[model samples]
Target chain A: MDRLSVPTSRPLTRLIEALNRMPGIGPKMAQRLAYYLLRASAEEAQTLAEAIVAVKEEAVLCAICQNTADTSPCTLCQDPTRDRSLICVVEEPLDVLALERSGAFKGLYHVLHGCISPIDGVGPEDLKVRELLARIHDGEVQEVIMATNPNLEGEATSMYVQRLLSPLGVKVSRLARGLPFGGDVEYADEVTLSRALQDRHSL
Target chain B: MLGGTRLGEADRLVTLYTQRRGKVRAVVRGALRPRSRLGGHIQPLSHCQLMLTESKGLDVVTGCQIIGPLFPMREDLVHHARGFYLMELIDCFCPEGLENPALFSLLVDTLEHLCLGEGGERVLRRFEVRLLDITGFRPELHCCLGCQQALEPVTNYLSPSAGGLLCRACAPEQSPVHSVSVNTVKVLRLLREADMETVNRLNLAPDLAAELEAALRSYIQYVLERSIKSGVWLERLRREFGPNGALGGPQNGR
Candidate 1:
């Protein structure tokens, strides 16, 4: 049977199509979601729709850091208690959240939104690199922590940014790599093991 | 794997240029998770042996073992950018499931050479010429496109649109022809025939190197009908971090 020709209400089909367009949501899952929404109370469905709309409407990129936030500078950037001398550069806003949840470092965050992916047609200019440079022009920041993911694109993005930041005379550091806590050293990749050994310190 | 993208929340969609099958896309289950074993082994530009099972859409990677991580290339920014450029070329030209082991070998060998910190400019030019040849787009460097006469040891025009060299007589016929010197032609021809070892022995004068770079990039851009994204970044890196008073001094002697 032609899947598109299945007898269904137009609105339900539209909902399914919209859901299907989302990443990781296949046709069957979209249909399931649409049907579930149909069975739910009208108020519940309206609330869900309103929440999605509200997120799109309310979320704005922070002017200072380019992170998605409700305000221009973002609460984190405006927080006086946070260390203004330290900046943690991350690939995504979620990473900022992850680092914030850790509570180990009190630093401002700069989200590049994406990494330098050549295959994906993303380059340094495509990212918010110029904005990052502009932020450091005043020389308030002392050190920049490269907290990009431990992947090739992420590392390349970090290096590209680091090259730009070199002339600014700010101390740059990369996140440490080693075996995760409770992970066996035997299973670690050679690169990780090598980095672990190199970064090893006294007990 | 040439590169990969995050899939869903925990998995990864990877593109691998295989020795037997050419370009293949497969899913690495839970590859985004911190402790996923496949995550580290399936990095871009890393040589790996993968166990893939047939699936409905893309293949599923069930097992993987690292062969060469090309770690040294990652240690230097220029080397890493060059590696990405090579991978981008392969990804652009080679179609999926078109088994050409020779092309695959060329990629692996060039990557290995880059990782070993060999002369980058010559190696890249050699790779481009050889890639064009393997993919059946080799330009006619020896003969003129219009008159079919053997090229002379003098100033010539390289018509990217014509996909070859044109003698002074034939130059005006092509829409856009880059002024290529005889030395550039000789070096390009040498790169076409020479092994990686021979290429290592070769050095390019700055002007001649620039001419060759321009001519080849124009040809490649013409062929693809679009510019390679990495090429732009490579140029930027060279400008900012290249030999002339850049962050790193005298990179790869290019």
Candidate 2:
């Protein structure tokens, strides 16, 4: 190894390596974060480390919706005021947060954890699809709103789930696709423009 | 084109199989954002014309225009799965920067055929045979590998390791082999020589289709030294839904 490979200490090098393994964090960014943590006070460093450990130790996937939480069912699944008939399916737990922030729907959610991506070797069996099917079979869910991202893999996953749910007698719907707010019509692609027109609502 | 992966928070890394440049992976800036114009045009299974700028590591996508969306393929589960399988085969077999217009045309044609939902598994069999021919792994369907003798109408063994057919007497003890029917061999030969239109009109019984699928799938797995992910999904769909079980969606009839 060269001089550039050497860190201030072994622990700092180890921290940088660990952080570099995280998604979207390159080696340079990892090193920068590691140094930032090193310069902080001992109390601050300890608190940060404790928080990381606590997240791993305390977090559990909710058995019902598969969302990460401290409880098996999570607060959303346990909430009695939410609509029982409508279940929105999303790709990840983070999506559940995004949807919750929108405050648009009063129904519960189902986290798929991932979409069907064959290139990545991820199939439907790898997802929480069986759990979702079982949940739907309970006869409470009347409609499943597919909120999967509007990508090829996402759409394929949504279609797959919809096929399974159709035979189960539950109504399935996908989120509307069109131009985003503030998006320029001139800049939009033909597909987007067409979809926007097709999915347009009556004024 | 094939598909894309999330690069970072808002960017995407898309893989495209083009006519002149072959397989190219480029980064699309802000492609994950809701309003980015580039995101809508790069959907997998779409035939798109893209303008790319040379960069240090990966090329940057500057512009995109969809030539054909293959909308029907994306709307149906069976077509979607078959289309993905074709993309996966090209991705695995075709190396980057190698030009092969014939293979590219074969892919686009097969995708279009799948979109029409006319040929069913026949389209895939033709694709596998053509792909093998293009990649220089064309299986020895007409002759036996062991004796270099012409194959008979009787049952033959396909040796994935030997990269061809083996007669009953010549089935190699040194390597693994799969039982291939005479109809499977005849179909493979026909698929290799016939045009896409011919393949679209040609149909096989359920048992023959299964045999053809199994034989070619084994050969592909052997040549690649790995199992195809989409193949597994296709097989699962067949088992769960029956031979053509992945049909049905809002856009497709049950």
Candidate 3:
């Protein structure tokens, strides 16, 4: 029998179910969260609810890079110090945050929203690819760094974009693949090991 | 086995084709984060042995051991595209929860051949014929679909719409029947029953390979009722790589 199915108020059960639907939240965790919310003061519950509502109502996709932002052009795109001549193409908004955390890339970013996966029925047309092309055509962009994930679909997406950008005179480059910092060679797979060997640098 | 997709930040949803259970999608926690233990093993087309823990909706991938990642095939653009096409074809044709060890072995062998740098067109043609055979969609190469007569050693038509071959006399006038040469028909027949060794030894002229590819692709399209996406990428890569392409070229180094 499901633990959540035990006698409970309708509103409490509803909250548990809603929380259960979220990623990484199982029934047990959902029940705990729901009961915790039930015990919290009304003002605390109202604040949490209002924050969720505000995020949906206020957060918008930036017109330039398609990243989630409160304004048309995100702060990264509008920032005067960022390199305007280069663009880093990634798969999702989360990737934008990951790259930003690295503090390595100073160029602007274009989120494709998703990768090209035929099994999932996601194609090039489904992504924000045309917008990227248009950005390249209309802007002073000279180089595009394909920062899509290091997977099959990611490689395919980067190659597809590279082909499209090749004739347009934009120098296309993919992120360098090697041993991740602190990654042990003994545990590295053949693909990663081979990549690391091929991309080895002179000290 | 095919690869996986990132799920919920640190987790990965891997799709595997098992001999006993067929296609299984399992979630592996902490697969995407740095220093992930499952990172190197569950890559796309890795051919790993997975231990799954049953759960509601989707199973969790608890353990994995890499048998073969087919790294060489993944390194080249053309080969990678072909490998992707093969995986996609299997995923489309084979339904979930259906056990067919023969088909599983066929996939493994075909992927191995692709990694070994065998002629891609021949390997693909052989894989198509064998896949159709296992799936019960094998086209009749010897007899005519319309008249049931033995096909003459002349130019005959392979009709996708009719689900097989048609003789010159039985072929519809305006229908989209692909004309196949005597050599093409013979090669297709050879691929159906022959092992990879036998098929590998047979060198196909560029024109014949193209003909075989078109005919088989049409039949596959007919079977699926929709166009294959990887096929489009394969065609584009073929054009880019040229006739002699990157079949035996230097590894693409990922």
All DockQ scores: 0.63, 0.72, 0.30
Residue B90's lDDT in candidate 2:
95
Mark the regions of model 2 whose C-alpha exceeds 4 Å error after superposition. Answer: A2-4, B247-254
Query: Considering DockQ, where higher is better, how would the candidates rank from best to worst?
Result: 2, 1, 3
RMSD of each: 2.0, 2.3, 4.5
Model 2, span B59-104: residue lDDT tens = 9999998887788876767777888888889999999989899999
User: Can you write out model 1's per-residue Cα lDDT over B140-205, one digit (the tens) per residue?
Assistant: 999999999998899999998898999999999897999899999999899899998898788788
TM-score of chain A of 2: 0.97
Please, what is the whole-model Cα lDDT of each candidate in the order they appear? 0.86, 0.86, 0.83
Model 3, B1-254: lDDT tens per residue? 57576576689887788877988888988888766667767887778777889999999887777877688765666676787888889888988778889999999999898888775668888899999999999888889988889988999999987877899999975378999999999998999999988877887877888898999998899889888888876776656655454453522211
Model 3 chain B is weakest, by summed lDDT over 10 consecutive residues, at B245-254
What is the Cα-based TM-score of model 1? 0.95
- lDDT per residue (tens digit) for residues A77-141 in model 3: 99999999999999999999999999999999999999977556577889999999999998599
Candidate with more favorable, higher lDDT: 1 or 3: 1
TM-score of 2: 0.95
